[model samples]
Target chain A: MESLQRIDLVGFGSLLAQLQAEGYTLIGPRLEAGTIDYGAIEGPDDLPIGWRDEQSPGRYRTLPRNDRAHFGFNATPASFKTRLHRSEETVLEVQRGEQGELRFVPVIPAVKKQAWIGARSCELAALAIQDRVLKDSADPDPRYAARREGVFIVAVHCGQAGGTCFCTSMNAGPKAEGGFDLALTEILDGPEHHFVVETGSDAGAALLERIPHSQPTAADLRRAADAIEHARATMGRHLDTDGLKTALYAQAQHPGWEEVADRCLACGNCTAACPTCFCSSYEDQVELDGANARRTRHWDSCFNADFTHLAGGPVRASTPARYRQWLTHKLASWHDQFGTSGCVGCGRCITWCPVGIDITAEASRIRQANGEPPK
Target chain B: MPPTGTERPRLAVWKFASCDGCQLTLLDCEDELLALTDRVEIAYFPEASSRMLDGPYDLSLVEGSITTAEEAERIQDVRRQSKQLITIGACASAGGIQALRNFADIESFKRTVYAQPDTIESLATSTPIASQVPVDFELRGCPINKSQLLYVLNQALFGQRPTLPTHSLCGECKRAGVTCVMVAGGTPCLGPVTQAGCGALCPRHNRGCYGCFGPSETANTQALSPHLERLGMDPPALVRIYRTFNAAAPQFQAESQAHERD
Candidate 1:
């Protein structure tokens, strides 16, 4: 069992400085262009304090809150994966010497030690899914592996659920279950605002000893638990994952697919916003002089007609086929590829999708069409 | 144009009837152009250089649409001289926004736009280069993306087959992780039927896709039309969306014709 400590709201800024002192760049959710995006932060002020986000299928708006709580929102569209696996990266560069000798240089990405603060429970679950896909496999990606090393995670428990969120149904969130260096539950009910911090690892415990904190009483611990419970209860959406894989596979040609296809623009927004979806394409660029060239890899989406392009033509040639491929792969075939489902129920797909297509609703409709009980 | 001392592949740029936006994309590759010049010789490009060289060129990048009788014959000669010909931008691939005249009376358009219609000497229809001669490849976009143009040039130089995505604009939107303007804001978007390129620009700015890159490989505009209808778009509005840039594309043209108000 790890130890728990109570840290006041002001002390959180010091913790960020201490992480910087230890040579880790702090990344957290900050307001940008009317939305909260994950970016670099220097102190507690950089966090989205006293700001709450209202999210729905196809809509997201931020509102001001009465209290000055640093993690007031549920989740940001930006995920932790952006830091580990960049959107675009140069993999190789080739140059020719004076003697006409060709020199090829592998562009190894410089690894940076990072500390991710204000991570939600679902976001942590998404990171774990990426770890299984990028690492702990037969062929681990060296770029992702290098960037993932020596990273610290500071998870914050959700006190309220967004309209699009369904983490509880996915059994992935509302509280930090594991996979975090430290977990914090903000207690804002009393006259003074404080956080009930719990260390999850030896490194976290050692860091906790360096910070100024007090022993949390029994009431403080209860309040932290109650906050998490309240969040889980208030979730606006639910998805029944019991036999979801088998159910989706059985309904490959279900009528529900065509209905969703009508609304689904095949825009690939859901997959791009999804934290676990890892598809990419390669580009070979030659310099103007034509003596040298560089190869780069960037994020790609399965929704693309060219994603499954062949010498003859595209494999999935219809909007329904493309939409079906994305949904089935995410909820069904992903289990076969990786030992887990691709979704962490973060609701980014719902919030970011231009047409406001809800994955949970679509899945439930498919389930009912396949003779399964209503969710 | 024959290869010079370095024996580098000779590249030529041709323009017919366009906004000159696509040709400017090549010049916009400032960093890559300096390096590309080292590998490939710019034999003839009126937009970038005054130096004109006689062909048979190794590779030809043709922009714009065939809107005149002279250009219709000239493109055939360009095809015969170039070893590999790749059409760039919507004008070269799908006849471009000027193809909107195909739906209206061309004679009236000429009389309205030009002071003397008899001296205009324009074809009734603006057609893509591929309609007249065989094109090796077609890069789709209102103005072709610089990175994609560089990739195609590199592939041609190395004698490797160039791979360009024929996917919908949805893929770019997803990869960018931009919130969907259509779904959330009820904005009518052509991203589902449009080809992937332009990096989902309109959606990033909280607007809908205008189908500037032409139709995707397997565009189901029929299905997407109903969704637009549900978003309160009528038949005339639907026709307007499909009849923008790349209006002469068969998929978009057929869909627009289907939704014609009259």
Candidate 2:
């Protein structure tokens, strides 16, 4: 049995100084380009402190919180996956010499140990899903695996949930679960700033020991529990995941698919922003010398009608079909392949989607039509 | 004598007259890419390699539609050189977006999308490769799915038939647990006739289908005609859908012609 360890939260400035001195490339949420995005930070001043986010079906905006707190709300537009798993990379590059000897090699960059400071529960769930798909899968992604192995996550509990959030339904969060080195809950106890930190790994314990900190009292544990409970009660969104895969599969003859085709431009913004979508397209290039060759990989979306074209014609040429493929894979068959739901309930797809298509609402509509009770 | 690993089959990727999106699907297999290359020799991919091996190659994966007098002739040569030939995108299996020319006057189309119409020398209709050659298998999409593409490639190399769905996109939607957007929200959709390849995407994103995949087995466009009309789709709009990417396809062509007569 692992014994519970003591961790004291110092002043924001002091905490930042401690991590900085320990050679951690501290990354946290920062307001950039008028949107909440992730960036490398040196201090609490750079964090989106006292900032809260309000997201509707298809809209997102930032607001000021009553108290100056580091993790006042939920997820942002940028997922932690983007920083870890790149959208596109040159996996291999080949150049031909005059001798015409075809020398082929892979393109892998030197990796670095990264410390992520303000990760949320949903984001951690997304990272774990990515790990299963990109690293643990039979065909492991070497580049993603290399970088993922060196990551040390510091999770922050969500005190307020966003409108698009359904992590509670996804069983992913509202509270920081496992898969983190350290979990932090910000508590306001008069003028004295306090954070309840729980060490989850050896790396976390070592880091905690290095900082000047006293053991947390019973009050600290209660404060942490209260924060999580408050966030759960304040959740702004809900999704019905019960029998979700079967509901989608049974609606093959349902008339809803075509209606979406009329409005959807198949722009593929949802897949791009989604943390778990891993489909990609490949390209091959010839060297200037015309002797050697290499291949490149980039993200691909099934939303595009042309994604499945062939020599004589495309098998699925209609926009409705393409749309159907993307949706089914995300919600239904993804379980068959990955043993988990493709969507993490982060709601980034809803917020980033230009057309403002709400997935949870769509799923609910299907259940209603089938005369099933809403989840 | 036992078979050696060196005797394993070779795979080739070819391109025709469309954007390189389909061929790009092969390159996108980053995680398994290095291992895939080790298993098979990339015999002849003009887009991926300049090192071309003279046919007869084991398997040929072709992308794009048949357009221009030269391409019509080149497709025949490709069929002859390969043991097994598979087509990968809308342009290759159906005529593609360029096939919209089948609805309008060809001379007018050449003048609209091109800077120098005279410089463009193409057939009056953009046709799929199967219209000219014998394709062993056909994978459908505007750009084919990477997993399906990989599946087909693996099957061909091992002398097995790939199990791809021939059902409509509606089947996929049902499996995904998405609500019927058309029935519930009164949104127009094309899932009834469109083939299943892409997992249902538009409806999941809270939108309707646009038929990137061509018609499925025994599609009844006539039955859909009234539903589209009730949804306020005009004759021209209905005709436009049939004539866009896979216009030259027999079923879609016949459907569009009927709309024009009406």
lDDT of 1 by residue, B42-109 (tens): 99998988899999999999999999999999999999999999999999998999999899889999
- The most accurate candidate by TM-score is 1
lDDT of 2 by residue, A143-227 (tens): 8988887788888887677877888877888876789887778776566457777778888777777766666678767777788
Candidate 1 Cα outliers beyond 4 Å, as residue runs = A95-104, A288-290, A310-317, B1-8, B27-43, B46-53, B173-193, B199-208, B218-241, B255-262
User: Which regions of candidate 2 fall more than 4 Å away from where they truly are?
Assistant: A1-18, A189-192, A287-294, A312-315, B1-262
User: Who wins the DockQ comparison?
Assistant: 1
Q: Candidate 1 — what's its lDDT?
A: 0.85
Tell me how many clashing residue pairs each candidate has: 19, 99
User: Which digits, one per residue and each the tens of the lDDT, describe model 1 over residues A39-133?
Assistant: 88888888888998888887777889998877878778767778877777898899878876779998877778789998899988998998898
Model 2 lDDT at residue A331: 81
lDDT of 2 at B83: 88
